[model samples]
Target: MAMLDVKNTKLYISYGIVGCGNMSQAFFGRLFKDNKNKQRRVIMTYTPSNTRAHELADSIGGTSVKNLKYLNHTEVICLCFKPQQLKRFLTDAREIDFSGKTIVSILAGVDLKTLKEYFPNSPIIRLMPSMPVENGQGISLISHTDDVSKKVLDELELLSSKHSMVIKLEEKLFDKLTLVTSSGPAFVYYLFASFAKSLEEAGIRKDNSKEIIHKLFLGALSMIKNDKRDVEDLIADVCSFKGVTAAGIEELGRQNVSESILGAIDKGVERSRELQSEVRSDLPNLQ
Candidate 1:
């Protein structure tokens, strides 16, 4: 029997990911343990022989294996491969039995119909979770059919504790989220760095500037979470028309940087949609 059944106190979750690259390591190594499997007994593995994969698995406490048969006994498998690596999984993975399992996919372009075609009988879910899941601050945007209910959603929410945040989404909206949240952090990091660098260049010491940036960013995020004010409104609260914040805003406006950021998001969405199309052949609109 699969070890993930909630009623089983001694359950073991077997996660079989197809890739062990950065995303896999970040997700598995950083967040898997937070599941708090008191037994320290979750069985995890991924496609092997790749150096990055092995390194990440070791970092995350997962066993490494190259054989697909390892999944035959797994209960919860999160496929973390790139789009180009999927067909091989579909072809060779058919021999395994997944009668009572859930398969979560992280490939950008693959859709539910295609996932169903390969693992037809298993309950399937598609999502694009950020790598920050390792840090407990990551947001995971997920979409699926019939694999969860409110009760199940609450159960899954438990996984978010101390290490991750999950937002349920309409399957059709996964594409927008893929770019917004999936690929968001790295981009945001660059923006955060710009803010910090500006402070440093303004004569603020590097460490002090970083502390200020982090505190401000955290405070801003908290406000967004606890209040009804929209993000722009919050920024407006800080920019008193001709004040320091406004001055910075005007400078950014002159540089057209915000537009460039928006353009980057648009391009990322388009590219993700294109990849999704190549794999699913009939993915719903990714916008």
Candidate 2:
């Protein structure tokens, strides 16, 4: 209840995080690192076995609680566990009261419908945040149930937008967007690694290859960001007829690398749909 208090100029929030996984840490860490204007009072943390909870709480300056009862007075309760863990947590926390609490979820493939069944009295928000959130440059997809109050939605948006580019999307498109934005970063990293390996094989030192290749990406990204020209035009500007870059482009074309990357994205989207179905199936059985 006492989330923000007047103290000179800074405000604070009372946060109670439920899980302490990588994605959870990414979000909370970014919020902690970027929120210079507001102080975050991490009230408590809960994790099975209590090891990670204690570790994360200590790292983030919070207390690790043994039970959900301590979350009663917290302003925000972040559910940062796997989708399948929802039922177990609900069952274990059945004795605790959750009325009027705002629940923020970062579980992939978990829908608002399933969350409503588990937390009928609490306002639920589902968000898919990428790893770059740790640097305050992530793309996050947000969805909420209709019962959420305007004030709560505004507050959540403000908090999320501070650390990432927040987009309000239909829940039906969450899986598809997750494939493109959330999983896309890993795919891009793999592509960068492949390019770095090619450089290494070409007699470049591994460290130098990595450094140069990463800077190449940064340069290309800067060009793309600054220019409004079509990507094909941008490519044309870089590749002269029969030049080294052109030769590389011709080699990629010969290997159908462009089509292959598109195929990979399609496969990723299909897998995302499969995972969504699996989570939904698990939910119906839980009810």
Candidate 3:
């Protein structure tokens, strides 16, 4: 399996991308660059309307075209389109024969059952990925139908897991996991920004305050990722014997900020749930 090889997956005029968006760029740009994975040739062309997608082709050893005509019957395809645009793209793409192709999708809110409707015969997969694939900083949860080729799944896991964390999950579970990982980064960044803003309001030197906060976060995350300790244990380590960190945390709790953040995360999870239904179309604009 390509995942096990890690260093090399065969390159081919195979593996097509239906939409070349931010998430696609992040994942491929990270995976294909692994010196070992470079052996695999993946030739992909973007749909015509995505004018800006060409910038990624050369980097991924792919191509840019005006339509889906470049797709072959035996190719592997990844769908990176917006939820609102999913129907139209699938409608136009239906004319193509996807007999031997495997379809992987990153469209949020939509389920595998809905995706199967478009490419019923093809092996269908649903994946939830974060935008950090650009830097290989996050994880993607994947769910595929029973009939999917093990070889294709292995190749994909090799590419995807290298750059982003991979979790082989059930289709129904991604709705919530998408909220945890898909939207979690932005939420964490928002919290950091809020703290920065508060420090600024307190008349701290902007540069010094920003650096302090940024490093505090970066260092904390580094520990969490490397230490293998539970987050609560880490917090306990920092808040030793009524330390300043503990006092600050107490103040935050008194102000109800933690409750607010919990509420916000809840809203984020619910919004992700709403996204799967066609009735929630136009969500990007809903904001």
Candidate 4:
């Protein structure tokens, strides 16, 4: 078991990472941002055709291992590859022993059952994290096997909370949460881009239009975060009887925008399920 060393009121741990991608960058970036846990180092890393491993290792004072075999003795492994890459990664990692290790998988649509099949000797935790984790403000949806020790889970939760909100949910509800928490940022970005394009069409400077839309979103998000009142009530505050905002709200209502957005989310959920099915079918009986 890895133990934490406390010095001058700080704690640190030793962990390893597999697959260094954008999401891994966000997670570890946030983890190392804080001075206290900056000492909680990544001891090893493996990247598939990316400079991320060496780059991150150099920045964090760690070693970049060319082969997955280096992770065999790691106490905790953060699995950050795509769901579809699970089988390929495992095949490439045949020489790496996962016995008694704790595997934290951030692959979307790969559930606990499938993870257990691939890393039967390790306790698996399925986590869905967003890109905002890079700034220490995101949400991580997690589910774990029953065999995980309470101490390990607590440590994992603390590690995640350093960068984002961590919510524990059953495997059944993870796909639905993935739609909002995981993919929702892109949806919001798309909405803002569309709004910015409209502003540009109205003769606003292109750069100004983008900046204005960005601040508009940042302010709204801040308001929602700080306000205690319900979102509907807040909307009511903005759309009080027969004003410009009211006209916009009326037009959106007439176009059934709410239903349209919900429909989009439903479609995303369906695709998530399909991906899960495809991965499971491809990697059946991995053990």
User: Candidate 3: TM-score?
Assistant: 0.83
In lDDT terms, which candidate is top?
Answer: 4
**Tens digits of per-residue lDDT for model 3, 1-287:** 11365345443426777776677777766666543246456566575565645766767656676667667633788788787787667567755788768888888777787667656688898888787877767788889998887667777776677778888887767777777788888888888888888999999988988898999898988999999889989888889688899998789879998788778767876876777665335323312
lDDT score, candidate 4: 0.80
By descending lDDT, how would the candidates be arranged? Answer: 4, 2, 3, 1
TM-score for predicted model 1 compared with the true structure: 0.76
lDDT of 2 at 114: 74
For candidate 1, the 10 contiguous residues with the lowest summed lDDT are 1-10
Instruction: Report the poorest 10 consecutive residues by lDDT, candidate 4.
Output: 1-10
TM-score of each: 0.76, 0.86, 0.83, 0.89
Question: What lDDT, from 0 to 1, does candidate 3 have?
Answer: 0.74
Best model per TM-score: 4
The local distance difference test score of each candidate is: 0.71, 0.79, 0.74, 0.80
RMSD (Å) per prediction: 5.5, 4.4, 4.8, 3.9
- Which regions of candidate 4 fall more than 4 Å away from where they truly are? 1-13, 34-42, 284-287
Q: How far is 72's C-alpha from truth in model 4 (Å)?
A: 1.4
